[model samples]
Target: MDLNSVYQRLNTGSKKWSQYPEDVLPMWVADMDFPVAPPIMQALKNRLEHPLLGYSVAQDTLRQTLVEHLARRYGWHVQPQDLVFLPGVEPGVNMALNTLAPPGSGVVVQTPNYSPLLSAPANWKLPRVDLPLQADANGEYPTDIAALQHALLSARTFLLSNPHNPMGKVFDREELQAIGDACVRHDVLIVSDEIHADILFDGRRHTPVASLSAEIADRSVTLMSASKAWNIAGMKTAFAIIQNADLRERFNAGRLGLVDSVNALGLEATHAAYSQGEAWLQQVNAYLQDNRDYLAHAIKNRFPGVRMHLPQSTYLAWLDCSALDIQHPQAFFLREAKVALSDGLEFGEDCGQFVRLNFGCPRPMLEEALARMERSLQPPA
Candidate 1:
């Protein structure tokens, strides 16, 4: 699939490339620098041949494809009707919060989460309760169960990010079970973003929180997408699995005319990705893992002042630049290294000294970014 090949996205209205100047290397946004999978492109091309691009609905075939995908890949069996198509996961989250959660109720979210998940509660006038995930001695970010339970006391919804963003921590089955059980105990609805489910590294498996048991399924809204894994973010299609009929109905109601139906091309691309893009995905995963390892090694040996934990999933790396004495790492890299990265403050208020680097690019690009960063940190002559 030529995973290492870099395409020029400049002047193509790419969010990643257009965010910075021409000289700057953008490693900020979650989107990849690689081309879309051939299967997805072919599917889009085939759909275009019909000569009609009107408003569309997800076909039964697409639902069946998703159903088979969940069962085959994650061993998570779900009926076809359980799926609710959305334009994007962010809207699904806001919809769930706006309709399901009571007014002024608290929504529990882990700190240092994706910016949208961190802010969705506020969009619906719901209070946000922060449950911080701390990194232990091994540099692994583990959830604090007791804290989570305590936070749930004031909250009716838990916004979860599995194979989490920014930090890239993949929650194991035991951890998900504990979380679901706690939610069940407190009657807190789980709105989980499993968008990066297929992007795991090192033989890791993604477990949908609702997949743990029927009890969890009844209280969960699992949001997923083919965008992240297949490098088709522009398609803007994602789906939510709501096994509980009543909850699904309420979630659909929350769309409120603002959140519209998925586009025609997105549905076709999504079906193609799940049904025929596995081979392409496997190669991408391997390439990302190597890029991750290379980045970790470079940070350790080349930049002693910078620190980062190996991300278990996702192509994003959360780098701690606290030791570098930089007041704002993201801005520092952009100004000094001419490299644009996601600002840490967007993820969490206390994350100002941190920066998230997107490594889903060709090896040469990754190396070039590292080289620029290393040079930026050098002492003046």
Candidate 2:
């Protein structure tokens, strides 16, 4: 319940912490700073009691847990046989691109997306057609339907990020339905990354694009995990739901020995997360919502030069520093403010003036990072 309490993550092989110097506060990575859910921890410990850590496959229980989870939570009914477990979502994305999209074909993606999703097309020798999300009068970044239709003309696949990253814009049902209908009309394959599906804000329910209808499900591959929601990313477990039998077969074949089965402990943690971590998830969601509000308020009142919008989901805030006239905002913040944020250049070349701040840590850490950033902009003494 003590969401605001800070803990030491340094020297623990944490990518977030080790990315920068010891003095710099890391607000960059998607992984939360909170401890793993008690259920997950206990499950892992229980699994370790066996003392035989061999390469493992998911048991029936794990598959059923995911199937039930999809039905109960998202109203997406998928069979147990349709599940394919993988090491992580990145591998799943690459697998989908490699197998589903033909070489030399185009892959349509939304701009200002997660770095991996933006770059995955190039990994398979596929051309990437970027459709930029423009902010409308309501301050919501809506997908340009006309642009999407045009992009799908040449592209064979669409990589979607529901409850999007960096921007944290949750695609509403109408938008998703339109997107699904477009894909159907254009005969395009749909590869959706719904990893952040469970981390929504403002009473928003995550609707998987594949769940819109049977037609959409037939052409969709949904990648989801409990990593972000339950703080079990270290487990490196994720699964893909492919309803189409042929597509599922081709995707499983695309693993190419590079994408191996998940770890034993990771499987245990995942099962616990979906089955027994509901209370913990609710508590964390509330905590993250509060942190999101706190960060937004701080940015508005204390840092007038910086601009941000409240993200509908996820703990990341895309801070626009264009008004500040800072040439490289990420580097400037790291050097002057001693806070390490995700460089916007990674998301997109044109986003160099933007920085993604992760507020999934304790409240004190969030406050301290903001304070340091505010002080960095002060005139020299």
Candidate 3:
């Protein structure tokens, strides 16, 4: 089957592409500009053919699949009892914050990060503790161990975004362990948002925070989803993995009200994706790798005064356009450049000079966006 045509079908009502207008290119939202795997489509269709949509239960096959997927991909032994289903990763974040931390406690998130990390805390009346990543002059996110320990000394919770959003630096294993140790020392619970673990490019490995140690595992809540990789964000399915019995019980406390049933179609899609989508996954990863490399080359070789980090994992490219300085560069690009990239302000304070461009589209689409950007950044002679 032709994949490009499949992706084009996604544009009918795609939040990532078609929402703005067919003419306006969308390199903004996290949803992939690709078609989901064939097996997933077949599974969803097969389930719908059953005719009776009913309440769902996590079958043993599915639980064992989760176990094997984790063990194989991440080396984490996740017990079936430790798993809790949620409507989405966002809701899972709120459930963890409300259940684990009392009101007024801070949820420490390293910024510039996924904005939902900022919003989840505020929506729950939990103060957000920002420990902004310290990047070198070249614009790479180097984990600051000292600052992390400082943040955890009182924050009580850390929302760690592995393969961090905006900035594409995959937090190294040693860095993850150091941060996990700090959480252990400060008695802070770590809730890792690891939705992008599957989309890593080149040879970068995603180290789950819980996989570092038994102690860290006991205190960590790992959230993952098929949405980001499979372009199924609207499917409304995500899982929370709690390894420790205490953490599991704690997470379940107020989760009764917060939890929503997993839709039948979503469950089928997930099972199919995990069980039969490996080949498709390889193709997607390879395609995204090329996309990342192409954008990296374009930015480094063609565009000057614009710095972008070639992410090892997610499709997000964090472009440092501070040197361009066109008065809120994110807005200028949207208005003048007619390109809609995510503003860095959405990730954190005082980082508005940056913009996150999604490079998960077809290479042709990306080339056009880059051409548009180049024309916009050119100085008037």
**Tens-digit lDDT track of model 3 for 1-381:** 343432564436656666565666678989876777899999898888888988997688877888889999988887888888777888888888988887788788887888888888888788888887886786667777888777776698999888788776788888898998989999998999998888887687889999989999988999998888887887888889998887778777756665768887888888887888889888888888988898999999887788887787889998888887666988888776778899888888887888999988778778889998888877788
Tens digits of per-residue lDDT for model 2 on 330-349?
Answer: 99999999999999999998
TM-score per prediction, in order, is 0.99, 0.99, 0.94
Stretches of candidate 3 exceeding 4 Å from the true structure: 1-11, 137-139, 256-258, 379-381
Model 1, residue 282: distance off in Å is 0.2
Residue 139, model 2: lDDT of 86
- State the RMSD for candidate 1: 0.7
Q: What TM-score would you give candidate 2 relative to the actual structure?
A: 0.99
**Runs with alpha carbons beyond 4 Å of true place in candidate 2:** none
**Residue 77 lDDT, candidate 2, scale 0-100:** 92
Model 1: how far residue 274 lies from native, Å: 0.2
lDDT of 1 by residue, 1-381 (tens): 787777898989999999888999999999999888899999999999999899999999999999999999999999999999999999999999999898999999999999999989989889999999898887788899999999999999999999899889999999999999999999999999999999989999999999999999999999999999998989999999999999999999998889999989999999999999999999999999999999999999998888987999999999999999988999999999999999999999999999999999999899999999999988898
Model 1 stretches with alpha carbons more than 4 Å out: none
- The residue-level lDDT of candidate 1 at 376 comes to 93
lDDT of 2 at 215: 96
Query: lDDT score of model 3?
Result: 0.83
